[model samples]
Target: MSVSGHLATITSAEENAFIFDSVANGNNAWFGLSDAETEGTFTWVTGELLDYTNWFTGEPNNDAILGEDFGEFKADGFWNDLPSAAKASYLVEYSTSVPTPPGIMLLMIALTCLILQRKRIIFKTE
Candidate 1:
């Protein structure tokens, strides 16, 4: 089946680091950030609140000549603005719903460990 996914919208340092280590591979990759509509109004493609940012020093500097508007993760794990059509790797987040709050990360981890154990149910009642 065809699944729908959106470009990654990073909201925390941990998420950014996860994306970097998991897929960025120290190379440039586009995420779900951009100011294409307004000159300086950046928003996530998934309609997430513009809460967290990891821009590199003096970055986004939306170049007047090149018209940089899209957000990309640089090699150093920081954000930068680039023009559309830039040939770079990209990440897609398959959340399929609102992004989860970071506060639930530990709970998710614990549940994942339980799943990995592959323990079968010892009792069942109907």
Candidate 2:
């Protein structure tokens, strides 16, 4: 699925295992799947296709006292249900299409002009 600029939408078993291996810090984490809109209908925050899942057995049970709508992809390559307010580490997916901020873009252009001018002077002296 074409996911960008949002929380990770892990779409394959290989990716899931890789992520778990990278972050096996023994801490619960949230991957931003929630059924806040409709019960039992978990969707990624980025709206990417729900093509894969690693749910821990009997989990996403929505069994929390307040309700378990949020998803916590644990360190053990399994997913569990939690509430949105629960504390955990989060993963974000950045998009290359996200444009540079105007200020940064301007700074880059100015730097490029200065470098070119320096090169021209060096070449003339040689």
Candidate 3:
């Protein structure tokens, strides 16, 4: 499934696990990019080579307990490829412009205002 241009790849099999990060970096709405690979080479639509690999232990083994043949992938908080007999879904994110939304903008502004208010109050009392 394609969500906002971020494609979510999943198996129709009920045992397959979904590969995506809906809450990426603590944000609920985020885009996850999953690329298909063969022979240790990835072919992502983004055109950037994915070299970030820190999968959970015992993961990406491609165990055929449910089924197999789809392939495998993993990121810090996401993983893919499971039993073809199991069902799965993909939740993806995409950006309309070249730059993505600054998720921390509001937080930064809030902190700045908080600091300023504190300083003003302290100086007033002094």
Which candidate number has the best lDDT? 1
- Score candidate 2 by TM-score against the native: 0.67
User: Which lDDT tens digits does candidate 3 get at residues 1-126?
Assistant: 323555432332221223333333322221233222452343444555555543347645555454433333433443444444544343443645544347777778889999999999999999
Alpha carbon deviation, residue 117, candidate 2 (Å): 31
The per-prediction CA RMSD against the true structure, in angstroms, equals 10.7, 7.3, 11.5
Q: Where is model 1 more than 4 Å wrong at Cα?
A: 95-126
| C-alpha lDDT of residue 39 in model 1 | 81
Q: Per-residue lDDT of 1-126 in model 2, one digit per residue for the tens? A: 333566667889997887787754666777768898878888988787897888999887997577889888887879988877778887666666556889999999999999999999999999
**lDDT for position 84 in model 2:** 70
- lDDT (C-alpha) at residue 123 in model 2: 100
> In model 1, which residue pairs have backbone atoms overlapping below 3 Å?
none
lDDT of each: 0.86, 0.81, 0.44
Off by over 4 Å in 2: 1-4, 98-126
* TM per candidate: 0.72, 0.67, 0.36
Best by TM-score: 1
- Candidate 3 lowest-lDDT run of ten: 27-36
Order by lDDT, highest first: 1, 2, 3
**By lDDT, is 1 or 3 better?**
1
